[model samples]
Target: MIVKNEERSLERCLQSVQGKVGEIIIVDTGSTDQTKEIARRYTDRIYDFEWIGDFSAARNYALEFASSDYILHLDADETLEDPNNELMGNLDKDFYYIRIKNDLGTGLVLTHQFVRLFRNSPEIRYKGALHEQVQLDHNIHQYGYLSTLILHDGYKDDIIKSKQKAQRNEHILLEEIKNNPTAFNYYNLGMQYIVAGQYNDALNALKKSYTLANNYTFSQKVVLEIMKCLHELGRYQEAVKVSMDAVELYENIPDFWYQLGLSYLEWGMLKDAEDSFNKCLEIGEEKSQELLNHYDGTGSYLAQGQLAKVNLMLGNNEQALEYILSAAKAAPNVTGFFNIFLSILPNASPKELLQHVIHIWPYQTERHANLIATLYQQRHPLLNEFITYHNLDVEYPISTLHYIFENNYERALAELNQQSQKGTDHFITNNVILLSFLLNNPNLISEFKNDISLSEKEAKWFKNIILKKVPTQSIHVNKALLMIWKQLILDLIQLQKYEFIDLLISATKQAEFRLIISECLQQYGFDELALEVLIECDNSHVNRQVYMTAAKSLIKLGAAEDALFYLSKAEGVHLDFNVLFEKWRIASTIDKFEEIKILQKMIQSYPESRWAKRTSGAILG
Candidate 1:
């Protein structure tokens, strides 16, 4: 083995081969520390060589000192895992490829096979200045593989940063490219650039290597690297085209399909992305052992996560949950897997999703608390059960929200009072103000209004409740209050509480809240008030939901032109069935035949529903 400044790892490397190998030969180029001293304890065959930028030259120099019939080479940071007698009994093969598991710092393990053990002969020598390869003079048909595993952690980020290995490799590779000008040199340079996070440089070098590469294996490697560089550069179209070619050329590689899926996802081609990710999973499951060293294993957990994301995009929430659960089981410590699972919760039944989250609460309690609180605010059942099971009665936001949702106003107020004595958190104070308003206690609102630091939405709610006056001008609105007000307005509208609705309308000056008030007015058969509110409101503060609602209100009032204008504002947002049907209805009323066709196509692409089918029939008929 040839090494340089590996004092921390040299002894461990030597110990792994103890009693398993015939002789230990180490060639040290330059080590300022105790690397030589550590080697002296294990082997007496340690030799010194002058520092040159060529790894192959130093490796070849070390090879000359070996006196065994078979030679095994390993780095100072690598160790053999349980070397058995059967592995050493493989004397019939001229060379053997051994599995190397490289631990990448991104919580991933990559496995690849390398020819580490070969017969000792004068005809065989090492080649290349960087990423040195072993070359043999004659064709050896007796090559086989060994089950011996080697664990390597030298490529991890902390180790790489301390050693400055990428910078060193880049310097040697650039010199090699100048002197030798080989495809292998360019490939090594591209890989080094990749390690240095220089995607543009990596792309150029890998492209050059691809053009010069004659070997299929090297060409495939170059293509994958180029695809990675393009993906990182946000060149999704180019990445897709290159990955398609790669998938066609190297159908056995799962990484190509996985990358293609990622590119397609970025390009908003959901169906294509789904197909590619599924293909990756299929190939990965079948060929789990043929993993690449530079890439994470696809079928193990990474592909499962990607498949979960793809399924979520396709609106298959149940399928997404299944894949995510499997991925979480495979990699429970990976936060991304659980994050994807949380994202799919909104698409599922709230109660059922909450139960699932509760089951996995121990894995990530903090994350589960935030997510469960969000769904609980949407009025999902079992909040009390969740609070009791997790012993979250003493927590700030969850406890406060639990009391508010339970309609135990006295208990809720007492919890807020207790929390306020400890210190004031902005979110907790805001919850206290909101609960006070819900309880219809003007005294409580007056008490909390001065001391509580409120967000813009909480400030709006606070002023509206205490002052009982609406601002005549527009202000920046809080989106969370819009949802909260939406639920509250629906309840008030059911009870015919028009006086309280008017007070709400008068208190907040934001156009967004005015839109909500207008909806409440329309529900009470107050069309004139609703239309007046919509006209007085500014369009800048309105969102897609508001625009759609305004358009529907205008359509009901026989103002089709005004309805079309609001519909145009809702174009870029993700359209639900209601929005699409409304757009189609407006188009049909206005005799806009071209828009009818586009809306019909969009409706058909979405899942078939009663509204979708009826809308399609109306447009086509």
Candidate 2:
């Protein structure tokens, strides 16, 4: 083994192969840490070497110390997962490629088969300054893959960033490219830049490598790196073109198909994305290891996540849910799969999404619980079932809110009664108790009304929920009261209890609540009622979201004048792309030619904005 400053990992590496190997040898290249000291505990055959930029040189020097008939090479940060003497004895080949799992620390794992175990010979050596390759006479040497696996975490993001190891490798690779200008040198340089997040540099180097690459495997690696660079640069069209060319040449490689699917998704080609991702799944593992030698993990897991996204975009919620759940099952710790699942939850049917979340809850309870809590906080329907299914140890008030949302008022009251016995009397719990009293015994509000003290806003909200009355004047609202009020409003909406909505409207003077009420009404197909709610709210309120929502609702109700009024109110307070688009719609509706001139000026001011993109015919054209 060739090592430097690997004290942190040297012992573990030595221990993994302590009893399995006939002899151990360690060649240190100027380590300042206790690496050599630790190596002394395991082997007396430790040698010191001068610092050299070339990895192949150090590795070759290490090879001279091996006295065993067979040599197995490993880095300090890697460990032989399992070593079997019987398996080693059965191997008659001159060399064997062992599986290496590279953990990138961002939940992205790449798997590669590397020639690490080989028969000791004078002709066998190593090549390359960085990412050195095993060199041998393949015509005379027989090499095949083995079931033995090596776990490596040296290339993880944090380690790479902290150590700047990629930068160090880049220097060596640059020198190698200057001296040799080989396809392998350019490829190594490009990959080093990729690890360092220098995509443009990576792209230039990878393009050069592609020009010189002659071996099919080397060319495939070049194409994948080029596609990755283009994808990161947001050149989706170019990425798609390159990926298509790669797929035509390497149709059986799953990575190429997965890359094509990603590019097609970014380019808004849903059908093409679906077909490409499906091809990845259909191709399976045949020749996959050869094509994905430097990458870890199968494309199947990521392909499922992509398919989930594609199905969601195509409005196939059930299929999307199934695919995402399957992905979560395959890789529970993969944040990308969970992210896609969460993105679809807001649009999926509440009960269906809840059922799927429950199904996966047992696999990764903490992750699923956090997700369930987020959905509950968003007032997603059927949250009562989620809470009940998991028996979540959440606060009483939130659980009571879910029960109310599920229209199980009796169960809601039961939860309140159970929590009341605990003697916890916070504002939220007190408010929930009062809500339960009102739901179970409407005439008994006077009995419990004086027992709980609430802020003026909370009092107003409670009065509205209980008495169904609107406030006489607008007042500043507290955030906590607003959250509780919003959840209550969502519950009433789900139960189709519109009669209580009037009270909800009256309970808060904040334009935010009025906007929420307007949106809920609109969602329930009461466009005129939504407009009426928006019209009643003071337009002087400078919240951009409220103004934009009001403008849209007014325009939907054929009240262009009212829409323009709200849009104008949002002029300086929130001049974002959405607000700009709303202004354009108002201008088009009222035939105000001057307003179009203002829009042109606005688009020029924010040329990269989505509103500008739409108006300039750059997107969706």
Candidate 3:
């Protein structure tokens, strides 16, 4: 293994393969930490190599001491997931593709096969400076799959933040591109920028790589990255254009269909999205994993999970649940999948929710309990019974939620603040900011907001939400972040945080948005709070459903006059007689004879309609 400052994971990697391998060799380029000390515990063949800013150099130097005939290489951040000396004992190929599962921060995981195990031939030396590859150019390069898995945590958020390898690799790859411009090097640089969230630069580099790609071995992979970067940059049309070309040439690759589906989903073409995702499922898992930089289960569970979203937005809840259940069963540990569960079957009683979750994840590991607990936390009545039944200790965030549920906002805020200082979970940090504002502690709000990670869309949402300023952009939103705000709304209603809730309503501008908050408030018997939302809408009930909802809310609050006024403000949507009849009924009940007579004339416009005739006859009598 070639490593530098990998003390945190060096020992773990060595522990996985210590007894299995014939000999272990660790080459340290330069490490200020206890990496060498840790390496010595497993291998006496540890060598100190001078830092030359090239990974292949260090990797090749490490390989010089490997006495094994068939070599299986690993990095400091990688571990053999199973003690499979039996699997190792049966290697019979010139090279093998090792399955690597990468934890790419958040709940995102990607698994791909790479040429990590190969015969120790001189011609099979490493190539490239930064993103090195096995030199598989020789005629003897016959490769097959190795069943052994390697869990790689090199891209986990904490590790990425501490190591900042993305930045370093970006610089190195750029230099390599200048010196020797290979398609692979540009691809490497594009991937580096992608990890750094520079989607525009990534797209540029990936496009250049596409133009120079003489060999079509990883050409589909290049197209994938370019399309991915385009999607990230919100160039949906361009992404779909590229995706169309890619899927035509590489029709067998499920990822191309998946990418096409994502673009269609983003562009609001739900039918097209449904079609693309179905196509992906039909393609299923196939070969050439080593040729693509992709995720695990793209065609099967991943595609199903995405299909759940499409169906959810399409209002097919039952279909959505089926797809999600399949996905959750496959990867029950992913918390986001459960959130989607909550989004789909939100009305499921708490007991049913628990039972449904237990059905999906029968094993009560911490992962299973956490999924149940997380689902519970999003809704009401903290599930202490379930927690006790599972015999699991609650962790932070969830622990904080208990305090919130118990109406101990002060204690919750204190715990959240302390937790914010230690580490950051975006959800937890968002709650900390939320509680600060809800508690009328604006001073703590700024400090807490900075603790949470923000994507561009999310940053806008936070700024707009915190400022109690209505959003000016598209009403379509970021689902994960929207859930955070949804929780805040629920908290506001639960805790009777009326003033803050009003500010929240006052801050929002979208008609659909105002309607949602108002309707939520209205359903919970907060008509006044609902009014805080409805009163903010433009004086038009014709097109806007919110105005009609507002008029109904006002009637519930015994503001008949105000209700009639809202009902009469009809310009946007058609002035249906149902609305006019509602206004007439209110006017008659409130003893507004003159207003009723005027409404009778206005209702006569639709003379042939039953509602207009009823209004005219009622007024005449």
Best by lDDT: 3
Better of 1 and 3 by lDDT: 3
Which of the two, 2 or 3, has more lDDT?
Answer: 3
Which residue pairs collide in model 3, if any?
468-507, 470-507, 542-573, 543-573
Best-performing candidate as measured by TM-score: 3
In every candidate, how many clashes are there? 2, 7, 4
TM-score of candidate 3 versus the correct structure, residues matched by position = 0.72
Candidate 2 residue-wise lDDT, 231-253, digit = tens? 99999878988888888888888
Winner on TM-score between 1 and 3 is 3
- lDDT against the true structure, per candidate, is 0.71, 0.71, 0.73
TM-score, model 1 to reference: 0.63
What ranking of all candidate models by TM-score puts the best one first?
3, 1, 2
Expressed as tens digits, the lDDT of each residue in 1-621 for candidate 1 is 887889889889999889888899999998899999999998889899997888999999998898989999999999997546645575877787888988774446767777898889887788888889787433644688787889998878889899978878888888888888888788889889998999999999998987887574456678888888999999977888888878897787687888887887776556566677778777775464554444664755788888899787555778998888887677654556756775676434435755676465453655555445544443333555565556664466456667765667688788777767566454554455555556666567556655565455566555655566555555555666566566556444433446666676667666677788787676545677786665334344356767776776787788888887777777655544445555666676667684667566665665323234454577578
